[model samples]
Each structure stands twice: as structure tokens, then as C-alpha cells.
Target: MPTLYHAPFSRSTSILALIEELGVADRIDLREVGVARPDGSGGADARNPHPEGKVPYLTHGADHVRERGAIIAYLTDMFPEAGLGRPVGHPQRGAFLSWLFYYQGVMEPVLVLDRAGLEHPILQATFRDRDAVFARLSEALEAGPYLLGAEYSAVDLLLSSPFQWLPDAMPRQPKLQAWIARCAARPALVAVTERERAGLVA
Candidate 1:
């Protein structure tokens, strides 16, 4: 069984939603752990195995996966029957991998910096700005409802998460807003929301 260290209302919540999507919630060992929030409320848990004590950390036997994109890839590959992953031979495999890495390498940093109101030519050159990132997403979403087109995948779960959490920050573009709504309407996300509201999750 895989052990997932999760913190409710945090980025780990996305992993919980993913697990629900993969239909492997019962198979995973979920252990709620404390995480230091941006508001400085929670503290790190000694039991969390993540080196950084981060939520969304997973350990299965000898292997441990960290980061949202990596964990999504890991779990989706582990359960390919869920059809959330594009296997190696699939035509969309490259695009799938690109979206995953893009969330980590680009989108996350840009969102964080933009939230902090930090902007400079150097930062813009590196990760571009929030508008540029959204433009890329908007261009892709214009083709279909999801990032990969005609199918909702892990990348959709990942890229749409930030906006779901901070709806005010979401772009007002029609396609982008519609995409967010589509992802938000997933039954899995509904369950996660209920669990959080019930305080059943940490």
C-alpha cells in the first residue's frame, strides 16, 4: 500500500482529489499531517517523511514521490486503468509530460511571484508573467475543454487547482473560466470539498 502524507486545505488537497479520481482512495494509506501555512498557523509534523515536511508526499515500499506533478504521474502510471495518464507510446505522451513539467517549472513560480507582487525583467525572462502563462493555457484550452483535448487528465487537475483555490486570481477569459468550472465540477473534487468542510481531513 502507498502511504500519503496529506494536509487538508493545502496543496495536498489536490492529491486527495487525484486519488479520488484514480478510484484508489481505499488502497492508499492516508495520514493527515501538519503543514506550515502561508498564514503561519500549522507547524511541521515529525511523522511526515518528506524532507521538507511537505504535504502530498507519498511512499510506496522503497519508493517515495514528492511534488504534485511527479506524484500525479506516479499514481496515474500505477493505475493506468484510470486513463488519466498517457502511456509512453501514446501520441499525447509528450504533451502530457510537458504539461506536468510546465506546472512545476513555470506556472507555480509565476503564480507565487505574482501573488507576492514581485515582478522584474529577470523573473519575467525566467518564468514569464502571469498573463503569459495564462495565455499559453488559454491557447491550449481554446482547442478543447481540457488541456490534453477531449479528455480530462492529471494535468487538468493540476493546472486548474490554483485557480480553484483562489478564484479571484483566475483569469476572466471565457475559455479559461469555463475550463476551471469544468474541472471544479468533478465528483472527486466535490468529495474532497465535503471532507474538508466536515473537518475529516487535516
Candidate 2:
């Protein structure tokens, strides 16, 4: 059985939603591994099996996987029946790979900088400026509901998770708001959020 080491309200939520979206919820065992105990103890323990002690670590048989992006890529490959990923020979495969990597590589760092209230030196910044990043994202999302047009991919799961935090951290962009609304309307995402919320309440 594939096991997912996850906490209720962390990046793990995205993985949970992805699993649910792929209809592989039964195939993956979901385990809650708290970052800290109720009495304030540290460490995730043997069950979680992550050196960094982070939530959403995954183990498939003998293979141990950490990091959000790696986990998504692994699951997509593992369950090809889910069709959340582009096949190896498909024309869109490169675009899919680019977007998949972009979620962690570009979007995450940009968000971290935005939240930290730091400004990048104009000449040295890879993305030109914050406005440029938003403009690119807005144009990508404005075309339709999903990053790859109508088809919802694991890339959407990756992108949507961070974007969920955007409105509070960055200046509200209209296109992003609509994009978020579309993502939030997905039944799997709704289920994940509700499950996490109920867990928190309990």
C-alpha cells in the first residue's frame, strides 16, 4: 500500500486533494503526523520517515519520497490511470513538465519574497518584477479554468495550493481570483478542505 504521511492543515492538504481527485484515496493510506505534539514535543517519528520532519511525505512499497513536487510527480507516474499527468510522448508533455516545475521553482520563491516584504534588485531578478510574474500567471489562467485549458492536471493541484495563499499575501489580481474560484469549485478540493476543517474542529 502507498502511504502518505500528512498533517491536517499543511501542504499535505494539497496532496490529499490530489489523491482524492485521482480517485485513488483507497489505494493510499493517509496518516496524520503532527509536527509537534500536544505537549510540545518535536519530531515526526518513524512512521512519517522524513528527515526534515515535514508533513506530506510519501512511501510506496520500498520507496520513500519527500518534497511536494517530487511527491506529485511520483504519484502521477505511479497511477497512470488517474490521467492527471501528460504521457511521456505527448506534445504537451514539455509544457506539462514546465508548469509542474514552475509551481515549486518560480511561484514558491516569488511568494516567499512577497510574504517577506523584500524587493528584488530589478537587474538581477529572474522574473523581471512582481508585476511581470502576476501578468504571466494572469494571462495563463485567464484563457480558461485550468492551466492546461479544460483538463485539470496535477500541475493545477500544485499551482492552486500556493495560489490559495496569494490573496492574503500579494495584491489581489482579478484573474487570479477567478482562477481560484474555479479551483475551489472542484469537488475533490472541497472534500479535502471539509475533511481538514472537520479534523481541526475535532
TM-scores, all candidates, are 0.97, 0.86
Tens digits of per-residue lDDT for model 2, 89-192: 87777878888777677777777777677785853276345576677777787666788877788887787776664557543776777777777778988888
Query: Against the true structure, whose TM-score is highest?
Result: 1
Candidate lDDT scores, in order, read 0.91, 0.76
Show the colliding residue pairs in model 1. Answer: 8-202
Candidate 2 weakest lDDT stretch, 10 residues = 122-131
Can you give the lDDT of residue 132 in candidate 2?
69
Measured with C-alpha atoms, the lDDT of residue 202 in candidate 2 is 15
Model 2 regions more than 4 Å off: 36-46, 122-124, 127-129, 200-202
